[model samples]
Target chain A: MSWTMTRKALWDLRWTTFWYALGLALYTLLIAFVYPTFREQSAQFEEIVRNYPEALLRAFGIEPGQGLSSSFGAFMHAEAYGFVWPLVAAIFVIMSGAAAVAQEVERGTAELWLSVPESRPRLLAGKLVALLVGMLAVVGVSVLSLLVAAPLVDAELPADAAAQLGVVLLDFLIAVAGISVLFSSIFSERGKAAALAAAVVLAMYLAWVIAGLSERFEWLRYLSIFTAYRPREALEGSSVSWAGLLALLAIGLGSMLASLAIFRRRDILV
Target chain B: MDSLPIQVNGLTRFYGKTRGVDDLAFTVERGEIFGFLGPNGAGKTTTIRLLMGLIQPTRGSARIFGLDCWRDATAVKSHVGYVPGDARLYEAMTGAQFLDFLAGFRPGIDPARRRMLVERFDVDLSRTIKHLSKGNRQKLALVQAFMHDPPLLILDEPSSGLDPLMQRELLTFLREEQARGKTIFLSSHLLYEVEQVADRVGIIRDGRLVAVATIEELKRQRTRRMEVAFSMPIDLAQLASVDGVQVLQVREGGRWVELGVSDGLPVLLRRLSELPVVDLVYAPPDLDSVFMGYYQRQEAITGERAR
Candidate 1:
């Protein structure tokens, strides 16, 4: 990739990345500090989870009372994965992905960049690299804060819990970013592309949640991108070869490649 | 022998079924400023976009320095610095950051040249792009486009947001650039904007090139106008029978009249001689009228075809 262009994208987006990562880290640290207290009354917390509506528990991918156990990873997953990470990651990547290519054309800056000495593919590749790094940094800071705070509280996270969290988050972030970039490449307006990509992600999450609510609709889990990484499985210290994970990875990477091709041939039309 | 700075052969583009520009052919020689003139939506921008390879031609090709604009765009771009029709940039960037980022893509952009352009344009790089006035933003665009000192400059309405003084500065800059052996393609809807600096002019109308000539040649074309002052009001309809004369204007209760003659001067003069004419003044067509003649003729043909 053109490091010059990649550096430019990163520099321009430095503040955005910093503030978002800082927020994620602060939230993760707060939850981790509180997890030590939950460890003392882990069985009582599981009983509270059992008191929740059966439909809500399924929607969150939580078993009757399994996720909120004494393990630090399970506690973190029980608190964050249910709704927080998916929402935050979707907003971050969708906003960034939409702005990547489509917003440049919409703002008329594509003329300057497109006319520069770099080829279109190289330019796009640089932006995508920046996006990948930016997303990783944001998630990495959040995960690192958990790893750090767990020791401070004299609490232990199962190795499997940490590993599964990485797999699920990485898989989710890649697929969402790829889809968003694909939409960005197609539309000249970022708002339109962002809206549509966000809608698709929202639909997938809703389908996943809906699938968990009923045995009859369990088939809808196949329709959800999150079908691959079960939060319950992750808390239980399982490997990541979960069903459809590869397809999700393929869809994410495939969409990114498709975006590159589309942009290479697209008329900036600014 | 070197190829011309730019050459387009039968260039055309369609936004789906509707044609944007059609069958356009022109060449801008090296070290000359070629004015591309057209009204809004007349496809001037389309031609510029095609030449820049920001958009591909549906048929035909635009080449720069003998390189296919679409296929060898990177090579072609190394020779061009373009100012887009719209000057919107990343609002979050300070002007200095924007230029530095732009410079990062091209190797060996002379720091001296960039500094000179910034000073000449009087742009304040310390300010964020969003805070800059429309004119200052235009100046920023000019600075980046010229700083590279590329052999070719494709400027689409480069003076859009500039004040009159800055516009003059830009024209002077263009001259200096031409002297530096740069070939410039300046697109504008206003004729006078380029009339002062362009070595030649090309007028496009309804996606077609109607005229391509030097400014002097366009003014010195066959179209001529005569102002006649009648001693008193007379029947103006009788003059219509004269071939190759069109009524351009009638004033002062129809006693003072101006008629445009593409030919048939003798027949029109003989007819005018019969009227109660006190005086007549023969005038060569100005650049505006000369270009307007092309526009009106094209409009008439379009009207007729529509009918």
Candidate 2:
């Protein structure tokens, strides 16, 4: 990858990265601040969670046998990691991947870029590296915020919970980034790329929810990337599915390579 | 390097079933300024994009410096500087930053030349691109293209948004690049601009190249307008007999006659000199009229072939 191009891509995304990191960090801190109440009223919270219907529990990303007041880490996973983190990271990845090529084409900047000596793959690799860096930086802010707010809320997290959560978030981002890049590679408009990626992510989440409602729909879980990221299972024990994690990473890598190939052969419509 | 800096053979492109350019074959020699001229949607930009390897041709190929444009585009592009028709700079970046970003893509770009171009174009590099006017944005594009000092320059509508003074500066710069042995392939619809700078011009119409000629050759083919006021009325039959001269009108009761002269201007002048003892005025054809002449001729030929 060309560092010059990578640096410029990162520089171009600086403001977006800043705002995303800030927002995610604030959300993590809010969860940390509210952890104390859940711990104190554990019985009441458990009763309320048990009374909810099974489909409603699934919709809220509440796994079977996992209570909201069981552990600080479990509470954090349900409140932030289960749904909010994936959504936020999906937005970040969509924007980054869409801006990678489609946005440039829409703004007519791709013409200037392709006119240079850099090969198409090199250009794409640089942008991908930049995006990965941005995602990591945003996740780093959440980790830092969680660590800083833990003591204030009198909460206890597993020693490696932050690191495990970081891995899960990274996996989520890379999976969505793959879809984003795939859509961006096909469309010349950033709006179209972002919209398609958002639709796919939302559909995947709904597929997982709808699948959990009945045994007949269980097959739909395979269609949703969320199935690969069981944060509740990861928080309870060290039982994160290595296969699922690898699958998420593999999907991202596979999609990225496919995007590069398509971009190489396709006409830049600017 | 090949003596011909550019070589395109049977280049064709289609967007679905719609033709972009068809069977385009041309060559641009070293140090020559070849102008690709056509009105909007006539496939000028499509051909340029093919040469730059920005888009693939449906059939046929384009080569630069003897390297296949698509297969060896990275190596070919190392020696080419391009100014696209749409000059879109990163809005958040200052002009200086934008140039720097482009320069970073190529390893051998000259800082000295970049500075010179910045000064020559009279652009304020300190301001963000969003704040710059259209003309200033064009200046920044020109600077980035020239700063690399490549052997070949492909400019598509390079002066679209520039003011008259900046346009003149651009013309001067192009001439200087030619003197330094750079190959230039510029596309434009502005007849006068092409006529002023192009050594050879290719006119495309409806996705086909209709005419290709040197400036002087095109001038020779264009009809010349003339008006002659004779001291006395002469035999209109004698004037009509002159080769390639058509009488347009007889004003002042046949004392003054307007004529269109094509190839035999010298013969027409001689015939007029024998009788016009009063006055004469001649207007050489403008580039627009010359351009139209080719289009009309092509239509007539197409019509005849249909018969």
Candidate 3:
């Protein structure tokens, strides 16, 4: 609601947005350039995938003997979405979210902001909105790279693949950012907030990996936020669960609301 | 006109079991320069924070402009311009940009006033905040708080990093604001800073209101420090036995005796003239001696009488 506050937040975090977006675009370009070699060696790679251990393939979210190398979207899933995008989103969320509140407190700058006539909710909302815009830019660059690279390789990414990748990637980013902001709101120390948020994301990733390797631990997958985004399946134009997407959206909104509730009543130590 | 700019009644804040400020009740008239004085960790910042609505009171309430500080914080804050004890400006932006960003929130802030303040502070508005030194940053904060020209100014340790000249400039600026009928609440641990401009002062110690008096009243109870170097060693008991003279220190085998005299200066002077004296010096009173005199349970000055 406060455009001035939002503009300040964006200006403060412009470099962070630029670097993350650049990294995603470069990584996507690398994968696109290597796609031709992967397509030529598809048969051999398929044989290798078939012979690979089932547990490892499941952990990597790759179906054994499938046509992963045959499609650029599927290749992107196994190479980027299965891990890289989530990791990037987690790091971005942790840094920006902590900077939103915890960094202000530690540096004793929140006093200046809170002394103004604006309410706490409005200030926080503007910061969070700016962060969301940054995340969108990062993911948008990745999508643009894929669209630009696919035509040069004589490969077409299905419309469904492009749309689903953007949606689910954004969903995942929002969820992780919400959790980061929640922790940032609770702690006055930015380092502590970032550390806790990172630990939670890593723990969730580990839970999903371990749970995928065995049937007995399958219940752990539900606890991981990453489980809600089945990017590979979504790219294949199958198994796109609206329920899962909604769950992720709900997590994002819920955590943000909780942060607002606590931040409104809590003392700003700075 | 508006119910005394600040009214705090039995305001107390407890950090869990530890007290931040205890049973503090005070009021500031509409245009008086009220100084809240205390040592470090004596709860001056806590009181400021509570009034700013950055923290809630554990026991009582603070009202500004007749509105509850907690429930109607936005309304209360709209009338107040505050400078925190440790002000950290946005280091990435130029001073002009930071001031512009602050001015955007308040509708009544005039651009001409902002320009005037920037010129008065003599800070390079084009330089990034990180490039500015500590004193320059303080000047930036002062410009931000004063540019808006709010009716009430709550400043905590406002002169901490300024050079002596700038400090004097700030005192003069505050006097001008006072002339314009602004209600100023200045909090400081340094006694002399408050004494220089404060119309009234409230001394807090150990999370309690120890004393509150006008500068005139506090000066009335002040003691003078006297030192004498005798031609020969004299019995120190002669000075210690006086009604209002207390021996503070004895140096050089009692030839030099430092004394704190509140009421018996004449009697001590009479006795000194009778003894063999080589050198005598009288030092004007400092706040420490005045505080020491009051700390020893001399006539207790209470805020109630001032109210």
Candidate 4:
């Protein structure tokens, strides 16, 4: 299989991928710029986080006792715009991956594709590579915007902040792509596959937040991808844990392998 | 004929308890046009998928050019071209880009041949496939299948969405390809289309093959229709006594008799000549009727045995 051919296949779905990346970048900027100015005197942000510290903060990754100017900026960039926004951006990436195979089967295009002189695994691998590249492009653009925006906003830029953000985004990308591939194999509808991926991501995110807010739920930390990823610790210039990274890699690879096994055994509906 | 382009032996595929193909066996000799005739749910698509190695068979095996279709799928794929029954294309890509994407996979395809097929099929390469009409999409499929000029072409309902003119053009194209010594395996429900191109046909129903023969042989062994009009009344029982003649209906003051003659049409015609025949119409058996008879026979066999 030619890598150039795989790249060409990626180019076919590039338009939708571009729009999704652009939307994610714009959403990040909006939170970084607009959300802060609006919260200059409002109590809504405080009140929302007070009652549901575990739910609200975990839902949006907002932390309390972080001052308005500095910690608030951190909360916006580190929490909301950092992991939450990428998670949102990853929804599109996952959607693209799910659409790559299941959509073809659903739309009856797999028949046309398989009729050509291409092996089943090679054809499937090409689509998987295309989807992975599309998601990586989105993450690349997000990192570029964050690097450019940090200084102009007068916020303290940690020495390794940009690198730490890159790591977090990479982990999320692999997790999303893997889960998407898994769902794509099982479901014929694009919407259902995407929804299942989102649900899984959200569940993992919530588990991590609970582990962070209370000591009693510390055991649950193992269940969440967030526990394995700590951008704040990384930004403080500490070494990121290898165990969590390995765990994440294992999950991603395991999901992808499961997908491959199922796809090989199951018939193409189209 | 050094090697068969495609061969199958007792191939069976099942989804749970529902059998898609069962004990199916056939062979396509090199440079021959073989037609697979069947109705919907007749295992045509399943057999094609198994041959393409898109799915594995539950039992038996399929071979392409002497290579196992499933085990050596990559090698087999490199030498054959296929057109699926439902020709679906990538909606996001333009026709030109889709063709380009497929062409990139085959290193041996001739660029000149690809261009010629594209032109002959009249597929607009500039437009996105999502926007193309059904006929145009099918044309795009044809261009992809024939562009490579592989040794074997396996097509399932290649003319389903084509108009009459395009269908004729496709027949001409297939004949030309056959002349060039390319084996063709095509499956379709259109009897007339199959009759025009196929040297031999295999009729399948409910995952089983009911009949397989050359076009001429199938029609000859089936039945022929003869309607005779006489200037005067003729005894119907006398016409019925003719060998191979089965009376269907008698009408018009007993002046006309419609008889179905399975074979020995000469004997029936000679017997009719002595009955003061004024006008006569003799017609060979229609392929459609013969094709239907296979299905009816299958239903009767299954239905009666069940009791």
Candidate 5:
């Protein structure tokens, strides 16, 4: 019944979080060592910017006067923090949530847990909290990696950049956790839930990219989760967009509530 | 009208078009060790699940200690202990951790009781559940269920993976728990096991409650077997007319006969006394025969013998 007990129970998956963080660190190293060499040797950047100026610019989100080195770093950040890191974090959050319920049902562990005095809602809430902690840990690792590499790249560690990154990471994590909960409530299979969540995340990312490239289809931006999330603007000293933050939070919390409602009413298979 | 610890009335559940449990109703009075007897797919597990409030019943309702099972599941669970037919633990957790996790949920679990249960079951607490043998895992589950000392215990195949000695120990523990006025609702395919502990037995087949009665009543209703060797040759055809006996077998010499009798065993004995009965053997009905008779009767009534 205690929040602290539930929090500790949620933290039980720390080993999984540790591995994910380690993977993120290794990925950071690979990008730092390999990407700069590609930019120095080839006209890859110029060719990409020229052929599809809007597409390339939208992809990397660089300003007009930014130099190749900084643009390259921004490009790396776009790839890592924007898509790769968020994707990884989202997958982890979804996996954790899906595993929390569906895996227990699959392996018949839920029966044991349910046999106790814990209410269904409290058990579910505890799992959700655990998943949030996992997402937070992933975001923390991304921030740590950026901080470690920023000095090495001669870039000052700005407080605004840190805050922006933190918000983006947290927002993405919440969104994915919500989606995962919804999927878990509907599907008892862990693999199927994770796959469906991944598909949704990818579709949303693609929608955002397509929206940004064409003015004719600007309306599509409203449908994309990534559209409301703008980390770069925040990094450039702009205030965090409260409207976008509120929208994301609403969707996340709403989906989670729907999941709990359904879960309480539905029959558990295992 | 009795103070039944568990009461189910017209309970029904379905999965798509398939019926999981169909109009099941029964009761277990306080301090009674009741047995739910059934075959492989006879809705025994479904009934247990419904009682546990793990699933919603499509029709009617189940209650534990006069509280709605689904609505008051948390309250009921606190006072009830369950061991599923397939007792699977969190494979990632050590045996001790799983026990501790379960213990943390309840308010007043005695550490000494926990220690005593584990020791009695001979379960190793240090190893992860994944690494333990099936028997050990079952023992761990038993320890968990009994450690809290709840008033009502629902076990499905509680002896499935246990060794003979452990099974006996568990049965003894159940007896002691019953002595303390606890109620137990257990389901098992092993009729003998049920016979050892249960005061009342409910037989289910094809998702229907075929019969519910006391063990003595069931035994009384069962066909009694008697083998007799007479000094004088007895006519098999004449013995068939004996009041309560159905001749099952006859030897070529007509000196020995096996009869399946229902009631009037005293009349059969009187008839046997008229002849010089060199040797006679009367055996009480075993559990297997009782189950077979029930299934056969059910098959005839339903006209679907294959299942």
Candidate 6:
């Protein structure tokens, strides 16, 4: 693959990556700073959490016994990794993927791009690799922040669990990013592609939430990509869920291939 | 492989029922500046897009150095540099960054070459594209297309926002490129620019190639309007003797005769000089009038066939 577009994508994303890393780091520190207060009132917090029903506790990705002050991994999941990381990371990937092709077309830059010697597949492959690299950076910062900051607040953070969960989150992000790119290829405008991808992500999250609420909605989980990720399980285990990772990677790769086929055939009319 | 830089045959594209270009056919010889001219929506951009492989032809093919434009577009692009009609570079990037990004793809381009073009265009590299004026942005677009120096340059309305000085500079540069054996496919509605350097021009109208003529041939084919004023009143027969000259109106009692000269201008001028002559006014045919004449001829032929 020609590294031309890959370098451009990385260069274009440098500022975005830096700011996001700093923001997520600050967010992690905020979580760490509040840990002590939760620990000081651990008994009261646990008692109050126990009063809630099992269904409600499961919906929040918290075990009945494991409440606010239980452990750094469980608390981290309930606070940042479970909701915030996925949400922010989805926004980043969705924006990146939508901007990859559709935004260029909409803005008329793709005319200059397509006129060059580089093949369409090579250009797109470069963008895909760049997104994956950005994901690694985001995931790395989130884990490192938790590992270094929690200790400063007199709380012990399991580095291995945080790293393992980061890996699992990265895997899930790849799947979402692939679909986002596919949507970008289908639409002529970036805003429409981003909106559609965000709606799909929201739908999957809702499906997973509904599944968590009751047994009658259990089948929805299988249909949702959120079912592919279980941060509580990923953090609790010694190793990542390899089967789930492999399945998500496959879906991501398949969607990427489809995107290539569609983008290659699509006319750059603007 | 064909030695010609471009060869288009029976190319047609339609947007639903509306024509983009219909049965367009032409070729650009190596080292020649071929001016592709048409009024807006007459399919100039569409035909260029077809040649660039940015869009597919609905009917036929455009080949560059023998490579099919659509099927082997990537390979075809390797030999071409392009400036889009309505240029929109990355609005977020500075001029330097945009140049670097494009240069990264074309490894053969040297740093000195880009610097030379930047100086030639007189654009600041530090400022973002959105901050630049429209003419400056067009200059940046020109720099990028010319910096790589591909064998063929396909420019669609390249002089859209340029002032007169820059326009002259561009025409001079095109001549220099032609001297170096680079083939240029210049598409525009501006007759002055094309008339300056085009070795030949192809006129497209209603998505069809109406005429392909050298500068000399086009000038010869266009009707010249002549006005003559005699020392005294003369009869219509005095101006009507020349077979090629038709009296439009016998103004001032035939002293000032408005005549349309379609052929043998030398004969008409010789005949006019022999008159009791006072003053004469002649209007040389501009490209616009030439184009209108061709369209009117087509309409007349169509009208006859309809009858």
Q: Which candidate is the best by DockQ?
A: 3
Give fnat for candidates 1, 2 and onward, in order: 0.92, 0.88, 0.86, 0.65, 0.82, 0.90
Candidate 5, backbone clash total: 0
lDDT of 1 by residue, B18-110 (tens): 888999898889899999988788899999888888888899899999999999898899999999887778788899999998998887989
Error of 3 at A41 (Å): 0.4
lDDT of 5 by residue, A57-122 (tens): 565544334423344345455556655766677777878767766777777877888888878878
Query: Which residue runs does candidate 4 get wrong by more than 4 Å?
Result: A1-5, A34-54, A62-69, A77-79, A210-217, A235-238, B224-239, B247-261, B264-288, B292-307
Clashing pairs for model 3 are none
lDDT of each: 0.83, 0.85, 0.85, 0.76, 0.78, 0.83
Greater TM-score among 2 and 5 belongs to: 2
For model 1 the local lDDT of residue B46 reads 90
TM-score of chain B of each: 0.81, 0.81, 0.87, 0.81, 0.80, 0.83
Per-candidate TM-scores read 0.88, 0.91, 0.93, 0.86, 0.86, 0.88
Docking class for candidate 5: medium
For residues B1-307, what per-residue lDDT tens digits would candidate 6 score against the true structure? 4567999999999887988999988999999999998888889999999999988888988999999898999998889989999899988899999998888888888778788889987889999998999899999999999998888999999998999899999999999999998999999997767888999999887798989999777666666677888988876675677765668777776677788776767777777677787988887555556764565567669999999
The residue ranges of model 2 lying beyond 4 angstroms of the native Cα positions read: B224-287, B295-307
Tell me the tens digit of each residue's lDDT in model 4 across A10-34.
Answer: 7766888798778777766656565
Chain A vs. true chain A, TM-score per model, equals 0.91, 0.95, 0.94, 0.81, 0.84, 0.91
Winning candidate number (TM-score): 3
Worst 10 residues of 5 chain B by lDDT: B287-296
Candidate 5 displacement at residue A150 in angstroms: 1.3
lDDT of 1 at A181: 95
The C-alpha RMSD of each candidate to the native structure, in angstroms, is: 4.3, 3.9, 3.4, 4.3, 4.9, 4.0
> How would the docking of model 6 be graded?
medium
Residue B62 lDDT (model 2): 94
For B1-307, candidate 5 gives per-residue lDDT tens digits of 1446899999998988998889999888999999998888999999999989899899989999887789988888987899998898878789998888888777688999999988889889999889999999999988899899988999999999899998998899999999998999989988778889999999888888989999897776566678888887886766677765678788857888887776677777777777778998886555555665565456557886455
Q: Deviation in angstroms for B105 in model 5?
A: 1.0
